[model samples]
Target chain A: MAERAYIMPIALRLWHWTNALLMILLIISGASLHFTDPVIPLIRFDIARTIHNVSGIGVSVLYIFFAVWNSATGSWRQYIPELKGLKANLDRQNYYVFVGQLKGDAPHVVPTPEQKFNAMQQLTYIGVMYIAMPVVIVTGLAFFYPELAPAQLFGFDGLLPIAVLHYVAGFGLTMFLLGHLYMGTTGTTVAGGFRMMITGWHDEHDEKPENEQP
Target chain B: MAAIKTVIWAAIGLVLLTTSAIAQIERKPIAPEDLKNIQDSNAKCLECHSEGGFDTLNREGVDKDKLRDHLVDLGVYEGSNHGRVECKACHVKGFEEFPHAADDKKQINWCDECHTRKFLRIEMQFDESVHAKEGIKEKFTCSTCHDPHVFQAAKYMNSPRDVVRQDNDFCLSCHGSDQSFEQVSKEARPDLVENHEWLPNRPLHWNAVRCVECHTPVSKKVMSHEILPAEKAEKRCVACHSADSTLRLRLYKHMVSEERSRVGFVNSMILNEAYVIGATRNVYLDLALGIFAAVVVFIIVLHSILRIIAAWVRSRRNG
Candidate 1:
């Protein structure tokens, strides 16, 4: 029998869908704002700005709830990368996705609650949360303030650090997101992970191929 | 013998008049001084032109340089409506010699020589126009608006007068009545012109978004909100929006756009106000929004820090 554990939680699934939908909206509006000059996709500048801010605020609320739940349940540990033999595991992961999977090698290890993400996946998700998301939100706020809000908050001097942090985070987020989408598709089945994301469970009864290749 | 003597005297008089006419003459060209032997004196030319050559007087002691430069200064005259006429043709000699006296009749023009019917028609119209009559403002001569010598006046002033008047503000200068000029500018027309006394028609006025949110596209980083003035914002959102305009300016925030106070966002308002403060100009939007943003960030950051601390404390307790 294929091994399984307490897979994705209902609460986690709710958060995931909400988060994804909001992000799609944010991306549409954000891309509209980013590619402002060419005048394709997004029709109006002000409309783009408004949509972006609203999506940001929505994400803000959703993240607050997610953070609270994660902290409470102690499930955030799924993201903390293991320190021992991390590099070799990362190498195995690289090989599995890039080469070994095509040669029918078994996965390095089956996913468990404690070892849900591989070293690379753990690092990438952690990087996004700790660095990327915060920075983008901060930058969006800075723009709003510069465009429409007041000047004297924690003082003019504090805003510069905030602005710089935002840009750095935005760039990091870009790199992480690009990599995440590319690698996310390479799970056990072509749509295995995506199916789990939608239905909250992977099928348990598929027979192992005598010469299994990804 | 007596008849022949009379004829001789008349002939002598005719010769004298001809030489005098030739003495005080100006042609299409000035006297050609191509040769060193010729003397082209400006004072003599100004004598008849500045004063009355038809009378006995001309301008007194005109400087040679000033007279020579008059050609450049008065060069526009060649392009004028009276380009064909010689100066002396109009400054016709009265019944006088070179040192003749002035009579008002000497300055008169022979209107019959041009268009007889049009001249009389204009004279009747002139009596009706205030300038032609007793009123100083209404009285405008044919030469008042038009430069008889040079028609270049319109060329230098950017565009024709009508187009300048067609400007958003320029048209409103005279047309504004019930509405404040600020409202007039913001509104497309007429409706903004209507809002001076009354607030806008509530439902119609309520739908429009704030002006700064849409119209001003200059990047916020470089936006110069340094010139706020005492008069109030001409570009404010409510100006163009009235129930009356055919296209209809929209107001109010929709599902996505959250427009706020217009003046607070508009750089034009800031610049006008900063004008009085002289050197000190500050944009509050950058800082205020900055602060608001920081507070939100700080809260999230504080939560994250607390979470980390609580986790450490719990682990310590367990250990």
Candidate 2:
């Protein structure tokens, strides 16, 4: 049966869009600073540095708000990957993405208010939000206030290793974003996922089987 | 009649001498512009020295080892900052005639004569330096570190890298080599590398930055010639790496202006020019990020291609 569900709330949608814009700005400005010579004219080195720092602080604040909001709404559970259905979810998701979709098979998982993300999506988001983002943010702050940080950490000079960690985390985050963008296109229509994210609802008819029509 | 004749002769002699003196005073004075354009008289000395000057023995027949101390490399001197100035300007009180007297040949140049006004502040600071306090000032004159003829302003150096190279080279010329070290310090000299055990990556640090950057105490927009003791040298990495580094106050003050604010996190514009190890952003990190993004894109494209091929084969088999 075709169903209609309000998976994303207005506040969540607003936070998501703002976070996305800030992440994009941070990445661009950080890139400009990293490659200083033959400067990116869109934002000069000084301006880019200012933007990167400001956006970093903005993203940090937004991340805290996201955590608080997720906890308040009891929606944080959606990102926690449960071991009970993990293997089956992974197998079905993999088959659907790699082979079944090619053969016109219906998707195994449907979006609901309780479980908005599939097992793969849940795992990926957990790593990005909890691991990558935190590492980058902490290292960035350490770099900003080097005086307070230890001169050496784990037998290496703190700042260089911290910088490397931040860079590597940024790389991981960038890859996650790429994968996220590609996965968005795998919906019923190219823009269907984007529309669902913008509005709070997803039309179940897009993925429902024709033989099982209500 | 004899007395009157003698008086007439004396009067005539006096008048003739007075007229000659007055005529000498009326002679044309040399124009200041002409004096400026006057050729250096030291060119005569360069005639023999310009060839294999330092390699040849002195007129006093000093040994080859001691010959180097007496002989000047004319080629190097000719290209120096003081090349145009007459040697007699500094080597005054001697060399009025060729083959100067043995005692007069040892005349030392007085730096204070011309530099008193220009270098008064530096001189004052130098008087308070460890070198002066320890009575080592006589051993290490201006020429000990800076060769007046060859020395160029750090600002006019080809690049920042070149400035750093020359500055380190000047310091290492004495500290790094035994021959030069013996000339300055009578105390048993410590091995340059061994003495710097506290600094990690010592050679790399030496090559990348000026010795004065760390050794000299911080002064506003200028390198303090009053070098600090080795124990007092700036050893902390945060001194240069932090937002409020003294590097901004001294070495990189020119980069800071009204455009840059202390509130701006990236007020230290020196990071734009050089990769300051831990402090500045690096190109290698950018390259790695780029490669990671490319690989991700490739994976997505490959998966899409495989999916399209699989779909085509399945449809053909069904038909």
Best by TM-score: 2
lDDT of 2 by residue, A1-214 (tens): 6577888889889988998888888878766555444322345655676788888999899889978888898878888877886797788788889878777676667777777778888889899988898998888777566545454333223455566687789778878877988888777655778988899888755565432101
lDDT of 2 by residue, B1-319 (tens): 9999999988776345322210111223556664455344675555333446544525554344644455566566644556556777877666555565567747746676788764787777778776777678888777667877677555433334566776778888977788887887776666777877866546556755687888888887467778776777877655665445566665555445522321122432453333353245444555666787888899899987876686688789989
Candidate 1: docking tier: incorrect
Superposed Cα deviation of residue A49, candidate 2 (Å): 0.6
For candidate 2, the per-residue lDDT at B5 reads: 96
Which lDDT values do the candidates have, in the order given?
0.44, 0.66
DockQ of each: 0.01, 0.08
Could you tell me how far off, in angstroms, the CA of residue B160 lies in candidate 1 after the best superposition? Answer: 29
Candidate 2 residue pairs in clash (backbone atoms < 3 Å): B80-B149
lDDT of 2: 0.66
The TM-score of candidate 1 is: 0.40
Alpha carbon deviation, residue B54, candidate 1 (Å)? 53
Off by over 4 Å in 1: A38-43, A147-168, A203-214, B1-319
